[model samples]
Target: MGEKTLPQAGQRGAIPEKQAWKALAALCIGLFVTLLDQSLVAVSLPRIREELGASINQVVWVSAIYLLTFAVPLLITGRLGDRYGQRNIYLIGMAIFTLAAFACSQAPTIEWLILLRAVQGFGGSLINPQPLSIIHRIFAHNRRGAATGVWSAVASSAGLFGPVIGGVLVGTVGWRWVFFVYVPLGLISLVMVARYVPKLPTGTSRIDLLSGLVSLIAVLAVVFSLQQGPELGWTWWVWVVLALGVAALLLFIRMQRNNPRALVPLGLFKYRNFSLGAFAVGMLGFTVYSVNLPIMLYLQVGQGMRAETAGLMLVPMGVISVIMAPVLGRLTDKIAPGLISKIGFSAMIAAMTLFGILMHLQVTPAWLLIAIVLLGLANAMCWSPNSTISMRDLPPELVGAGSGVYNTARQVGAVVGAAALGAVMQMGVDSFSFGAAMGNALLLPVVFLLAGLLAVSRFK
Candidate 1:
């Protein structure tokens, strides 16, 4: 089969092999940073609380606020990239992220740290969407699986190592250095993108700033309401804020449907695959991040594991995921994506069920460690294949939008999972049992997997 060709920027010729590799490397770094940030704070949360004198709620925002900021702007940013140029947006985002990391390191108060995390989220929003855009522009369909496989593998493995690395850094250097770790990586990634990322101009439209603003308001209100509801007793004002948020979202959707220069073209949803795939991605993202945060708590706080030891215990899962993700991604391209997705989801179910049962029984450390490793293997298969399958069916024109849309699900899920599961465990709603809270959280992945199975079954 011949390589598929897409239009290039400035009427340039075909993308060269070296340029594609460079773009991939830059993209991998961006993906790694985003995923790393997702879990890197887990081990350090206690330290941050002690140093910053953060309350339970304030500390959660250190994580939740970042996710809310990240998730809310993705679709808008993706569209902005299309309108203003992805390379420029990506470069700007990296710079912002780097600075935000520095700010986070210097933060002396929990509020300051939370604010900096929000800044990091915004920067992350810019960085995360462009990689898929680059992949769509540069790689032919025949090569996309291998290319994206590598991308997915790098991203998934980052989650495995991020906490471990954060743990060690907190134990040795300080928790602040976790934020600083991105500086050198960001600098290197910036150079790669500047040289290799093609500078495609905005086609015709300016960024629909009004639409972006509305989205920001809506998501922020909703996320804030959700995050605070459990603690605040879900008062009338919380409900009011949430209701207003829903209304704003509805209004935003209406605006997008009617606007000539919509931030995200409403028509993208016409693709059955894109719609269903995005849903699956969202649910999967929620389950994945949810698993990371509480598990860290269980290991460190519940079991009294040292930061370094916890980090070491997580290594097997990282290794397994790193090895398995690419393999599953490659499999996604050939055998039915749904079948692969189903298998992956099934693995997730097994992993979560085992985890809940083992933790409930207060199993021995050796056995518990084994369970965590198995969970990693299951996650490896689920995450990569699911990501590959979700994006595979998009038209070239829709690729950039698809990237943003897909990631939005991931981020939103992370926020929701963290907030929702945290509430359950902290409030003792899940039987005052950490194991029960975990079991309840595991149900989310099961539901998402079932939905993925249905999506795959309906595949044309």
Candidate 2:
């Protein structure tokens, strides 16, 4: 009787392992295009500013608004996946994102572009959390890491080629092509998801709408203050808004604590690994999202390298990351603790420390490239293994909520990291030489990596 009813509750028990892997691949591809669009658009921003006759301030919104819309609502979207169905939410997101991309391509003005990008980003949020939940539902425990490893690898690889691809697209075909390219990829993902990914059982019954609202407002204010702070002078009002955001965030936490069926599921934190994993991922988010700024500034502005050459220097990091993620995932399936992630974070610190020293000592590009390779391997270890370990002990019922909270933490870290690094970079640039300023900024990642290392070290 249990076996007979199992297909309706969560269908993966009836899914063949080979077919489940196919579903995971399709989901990963969907994840790929969304991530690719982010890096792709970033490369096109300068051209966008030139063509649209926009100021630097207005142009930054083209990027900032997308990030704001995407990161802020992830908590809600994740629960939406559980309340509805992962496949349904993913298909809807792909359609919305694809449509937004097409609209963005034809946008006549910067304002239109910004508005459409927000739509595009919201679509992305809808797609992001579904994959993890889908993976959990379709694959059994022992096979999950290998499945997650491939997911992690493809995810890392998506950005690896983005700069090169974006540069080529923007240079040859025009900035519009960057947005146009995704129309087909999005459509393909929509079809693939429709055909390949199964609709999983909805796990969540009630969503904390009030908590979601508070979080949205608080995150919006905080992210706005941070994104605009450099331009807006961090005035008295900005400080006031920032403080209110913090207070609202605290209130959201309190609300979650009081609500038994909270969207966030505080019970997940009862497992020591989940709490530590969530924290570690946040630190990883901080480093991964912000580290690029100083490196690019150092190479392009300070060292006088061509844009192509400077972008090429980072390729080693991407290459190693792609190669190592699945291997790390396989290791994660075998190990209960985060021994691998701990070592990875440690290597990450070492890599950043070496890279920073090389920059300060004015080393050649060749040596710095080698340092980046080490950073790549370290990052590879951190991402897949850490993610696998985080969810390893999660309750089956709270999987969707866990994915939501975990990823929300990751994006929150990314948002905060980018803002923190920008502030630090600005301060350093003001007080020191170009190289010195960038070098100091580079040190920031090492500090975050230290925190990540400490988090994983406590894994038991």
Candidate 3:
């Protein structure tokens, strides 16, 4: 298969081994920029709030809106890649994301920044799934685990490093540079994609626009309700929105069941590995997103570390994940992914538990770094293996749909995590000290990681 002939334009064929790896690199560049932007705003949020004279709720919306918009459209955009070309859609998405980043850097008000971030999210939704789908298509099953490992490593590293980069930029140049930083990265990714990523065969199935709209609405409503609930003091409207979201979700499920060309095929759920793997990934997202901000706050606010120093503390997580991902990815291909994931989740649970205890006690930086390193190793173990296992059994035709569904689950988990953590921190502030609040909030991710462990346990 490695020596097989290449496809002519508009068709699928075996990409030569050299070209396939190059394509993976290009895809990873794009993935890195997108994931980096997701967390880049974290350490800079306070600066953004102060500079723009924004209220706390408005500033939180800056992050929440991006997650919400990004999560909502993933179901449809994955199909867009399938029906159109993944390469083409990726290029378009990258372009929009780049342009949006520039606009975000120029925003004169918090509302403008929030609106532009949503645009960035829209672009991100289009780009997120294509790499997974492309990797699934281009690599032989035996080699895919390693490719996905590289993919996971790039994403995880970007996420961990974003705050560091954001801190340097925010502390020195300004927060706007965080958005400006993406412009060059996006251009490099665009060039790489255009030059290396081959045009794959496009699907002919009709897109279920109604089902997609329903799904988007449901997600938006639920995320809005959760994100605003604490800020609004759990108003009557919050429950109303939550109920409406649930109702919309049921309707979306019904629509999916009836449509042969659903954005998310109901039949994909029949595969136990995919279902469980997706759930576990969502839990992973929940843990990461929910815990990250509080940790940053604890380091900078409670411990009185500088933003740059606080950001540097997370370097171990990225470095360890980069080093360990390929090893774990290769291992994933040879072992039962469920077992590896169980080990990973155990590490994560232990790390988070230890982190909470240490933060509550105000331990030395050495102990905190140890916990971060453990979390990084756990990240390396979990992401690639879960992704490889989840999509291993998907038919070629379902790859795009499955990728979309998997990414949607992860992003939705992130949105919910951010919201739940916000609410928890708010409660803590009202009842106790901020440090204690953050420590209490850390326990939630442990619960999420444990839930992920339970999900993966069902995987054969």
Candidate 4:
């Protein structure tokens, strides 16, 4: 009765181990693409600007558009996966992403490239939620941290290599190869999804189209305002967009109360751990996206490093995160998750503070390398275990919707963080000392790290 009700496959009450690894592999592919997309663009941005004759605003938009689109659709798509089928939705997203990559590579104009990038973001939104949703369905609770740890490792490893790979491709072959490079990997993943990614039966609830609309409007308005505010000088549109977004959010919450099949189930937040854990994940997302772009810009412009060289500098951080996540996940089961998360948050704070000091002194390669190592270790500590704790106590039926909400928060936070940080750096370009903008950006991560520590306190 438990096995039948649980939606997990067990032979006379024992979950099979082989299927777990298969799910992990499929998830790794999805994560690799997502993380790779974020980092690969870092080193390639300058080249992209030069070839396409893009201004600083347009260049930044390349990253911005991707993140904004990526964040918006995650909740809706995740629920759609639960309702339609995780396997099917995931495959469709991958197909769209792979083909979109080709379109991005061939784009003859900057406008065309940006447009395609928006399309790419939409496709990406579908990818992030399904893998974790699949994991939640397949893995039993006791072993989930270990599973998430492996998934986190793959994500970090891909993030680590993306810049290096993008740098090399941009320097030797051309920026076009950055997009073209994902082709074979996508093809392989498509095959894997077809063969290994199992399909759950479609759910019965009707799609909540209105709720999805309000959510999207709210998210887009806020994202646009934040991204454009520094550049636009607090225009009416900024205020209007933000106000509309806030209003839309209120409406979304009101609608969710009545809609039985809401995109994000409000009831999931009734669980204290789940609510706090989701907020912490959002803060972590804020830290990562906020930190990454500025560091990339500084590496290339301020430090006088080539795209590839700067990318290689980030290698240590990526490597440590990849190596530590799974190991830490396994340890989480034996130890308390809150302790693990506290340690992780502490590491991140230390890394960010040290990075601030290093940037103030000089933007040297050695300093960057040391900071990367610390950042990677910190990332490994926070993400995997925090994710484990986030969903630890939820009912099985709620996992899919919960994964959607959790992922949506993460994606939305990343978008907001990137926008805010980008604005700070731009303002820093004019208002403060040489290092002021970068230093100001560090405040974001510090605040998030503190918040994470506070949230982890509630984990048990």
Best by TM-score: 2
For candidate 4, write residues 1-460 as lDDT tens digits.
1112234532221235576677578767876887689878766788899999999889888877887888777768878787777777788888888898889999998899999999888888887788877776677667778888887677556656776888788889999898888778888888877766666555538778989999889888877787667778988878998899899989988998956877777888898878988998888878875686667667777777776677778878878898899999888767975888889889889888887777767657576677788889988998888888888667656767888888877766766677677777777879866565676676657876788789888887
Q: Which tens-of-lDDT digit does each residue in 1-460 have in candidate 1?
A: 1323246522232376577877888878977897788788766888999988889888877887777777788888787667666777889999999999989989988988999999998999898888877776676665566667778777667877887798788988999999888899999999988878776534537667888888888877887887678778889999999999899989889998867777777877887767777787666766777776566656766678766776787788888877877776667767765676666667676777777777666555577676677777777666776666667656655667778878777777766766677775665543656655554555445665566556655544
The better candidate by lDDT, 2 or 4, is 2
Clashes of each: 0, 0, 0, 0
After TM-score superposition, what is the CA distance of residue 334 in candidate 3 from its true location, in Å?
A: 1.4
RMSD of each: 3.9, 2.6, 3.2, 3.0
Instruction: Give candidate 3 regions above 4 Å deviation.
Output: 1-13, 432-434
User: Between which residue pairs do clashes occur in model 4?
Assistant: none
Q: Give per-residue lDDT, candidate 4, residue 113.
A: 90
lDDT of 3 by residue, 307-374 (tens): 78888999999999998997888888888668888898899999889888887887766678889999
lDDT tens string, model 2, 1-460? 1211124323343367887877887788778887776566778889999999988877788888888888888888888887888888899998998999999999999999999999999999999888987777777777778777887776665665677778788878999999999888887777777777765556677777788899888888787787777678889999898898899888888888868668787788898888998899889878776777788778888889876777788888888888889888988888867888888999888887886788788766777887788888987888888778788557667777888888878877878788788888899878988777777777887878898899999988
Q: In model 4, what lDDT does residue 457 have?
A: 80
TM-score of 3: 0.94
- By summed lDDT, which 10 consecutive residues of candidate 3 come out lowest? 1-10
Stretches of candidate 1 exceeding 4 Å from the true structure: 1-14, 53-56, 108-111, 427-444
Error in Å for residue 320 of model 1: 1.8
Q: Is candidate 3 or candidate 4 better by lDDT?
A: 3
Estimate every model's Cα lDDT from 0 to 1: 0.75, 0.81, 0.84, 0.78
Error of 2 at 183 (Å): 1.2
What is the full ranking by lDDT, best candidate first? 3, 2, 4, 1
